[model samples]
Target: MSPELNAPGISEEDKARLTQSGIELSMQNRCGSYLQMNQDVLHAECQEEGIEVLSYRKAMEKYDWLKEYEWKAVPKDKDEITQYVASQTDPKGYVIIAHKGTKNILPIQACLYLGRETIQHVHNIIIAEEGAELHIISGCTSGGHVGQGAAHYGVSEFYIKKNAKISFTMIHTWTENIEVFPRSASIVEENGVFLSNYVCMQPVKKIQMYPTATLKGENSVARFSSIIIASPSSYLDIGSRAILEGKGASAELVTRAITKGGTIISRGQIIGKTAGTKGHLECKGLILKDGTIYAIPEIDGRVVGTELSHEAAVGKLAQEEIEYLMSRGLSEDEATATIIRGFLDVKIAGLPEALQKQIDATIDVAEKAGF
Candidate 1:
């Protein structure tokens, strides 16, 4: 057994259950890392490799990069709801600092269970030195069929040096009573690439978050895609932003939203500040009864040769499809839920097989829940 499995307060049962939610552990994984934050109790484990993963306390004591980007992602404004959690945050969290020329795959998981913080405050920092290449998979969720409401406020910052590449995938699956807020940012140097994939498979009461990326060097690239599903009695306001500030820098943002009920505000933006820049934002929404969907895409620039655009579409499932499902004796809600479930389907190249299987299982669970 791995020594990380022996970490205090780390539940093996939870680990096993989460594997069904797209948190896969494979032998090909690089210097395995697993973090599960249940309420205030956070447990972490990491293998020795070029990528170093440490707890917030240990990382602060060992690394030279801590505090350099403090208050950069989530500002400490008094009016910001995340400010309180940032102020009262516990000393537990994870920090991943990668070495130069390292090839790594790291997995990070967070969940709400057991009790309150039932609001969890975590500070995640990721650093990739020059020439480093990394693939990171992260998943956040709440317990199954849980009753009590919980919240998660996460502050994350990423720094990618010149020629380095970081591919990140985040999956969020929350029960009906959970609320999630994630504030994140990334800085990429010249020739660096930052790719992000986000998916929301489970339903939450309310979730509002906007993660942004800044391309600061020539020839840098940033790509972001999100797939979101909202259940009845849920409210989700999600968005992503990209700022192209370097020569030849480019960015693209695409999002797919499906609402079974409740409300979803889908927003995206791309702001270009330099010549030879290209950016676009695509927003799509699918809705059912008692659901409200709002798509807002913004593209702005001040320089010529800096091209930006957006495409948005919102509508419901075809009546014929719903009627066909109903003919199979499925209830209206179930029929609508089935169509919404299929609309959330996403097939991306190069995703891990284990992770894909877990995602399939996660979709099944979410469909059974409602949508």
Candidate 2:
């Protein structure tokens, strides 16, 4: 086994205990092995015919100390893998760091399984060493679990080193009576780049979030892209931000939101500092029904030599495009679905092969429910 597999944190006994207990869902470490994720144990049974036990905590401890990090999926049970790193944290909870390696290879993925009557707080941290590259994928769904009292609070923090690159892709969905609070932020160093892709599927409750990235180094860059859909009683207050400093730094913010059954508010900002810096913010929203969607894209330039720009558009799906698709053998709903799928494809297409297929299947499931 690789040294990364023997690190310490979760125990082997716990892994075995959780394996024989509950519905064994899919949980994979950087080693790419599936295991059960019960709250009672920190590790899980290996899927390769019991070849090895998967330890969540120990998996996280495998990476370099300079790259300390954490990861956790929502609807976390008591035996979930989380650590109490701080005391004054709001929405008191634990954080699970899946990997913090000096070299970023495979993308990290987390799937949140929620049912009726579930409430949870999940926090994650990602650290990319100088010149490292990393990609993180997250999917939130409530497919098999259902009842009531289902709520979740998710928080994420990331730190990128000089010349590093990090990308985050998040997909959110929930049934009726579900509420979510997702808070995230990242810090970028000189010559580093941070890119975020936010995809929101059918959500019936309220989801308020703002994923921000701060460019504190010279020539650092940030980009934010979003695809949001809100239906009956759904609310989304989400956006992105970037702050640039030093010479030749830059930032870009872009988003696409659609409201049908309820309301959505998008707020985005990009700020520039000192000479040789630039910033841009863009937002576009599509309203499919009588619901409302407010757009706010702000750009601030603090230096005389810096450039700042922003653009926003809010409207329904273009009738011409819809009609054109309908004329091409697609029904009204199909036409709308096609467009929505295309909007999301640009982002999901860049994910890892395994993850890309999963995201595509997720969209297919959502479209079958009328999106």
- Per candidate, the number of residue pairs that clash is 0, 15
Q: What's the TM-score of every candidate structure? A: 0.84, 0.73
Q: What shift in Å separates residue 143 of candidate 2 from its native position after superposition?
A: 5.8
Model 1: how far is 199 from its true place, Å? 1.4
Q: Which candidate leads in lDDT?
A: 1
Per-residue lDDT value at 194 in model 1: 86
RMSD to the hidden true structure, all candidates = 3.8, 8.0
Instruction: Assess the local accuracy of residue 316 in candidate 2 as a C-alpha lDDT between 0 and 100.
Output: 68
Predicted structure 1, TM vs. truth? 0.84
lDDT of 2 by residue, 1-371 (tens): 12122212324543222222211223433323222121222233222221222333444445455233433211233222223322214423222232233433445544444444656555555556677666555656553345457776666677777887777667666665777777677888888877787777675588877777878888887877777788877887888878777578887777777787688899998877778888888787777788888998888877689899888888767889999999999998889889876765645323455445545665676677776
Best by TM-score: 1
Q: Write the per-residue lDDT of candidate 1 for residues 260-313, one digit (tens) a residue.
A: 777889989999999999998988888766688899999999888898999999
Query: Candidate 1: where is the Cα deviation over 4 Å?
Result: 1-17, 24-30, 39-43, 105-117, 145-149, 319-342, 348-361, 364-370
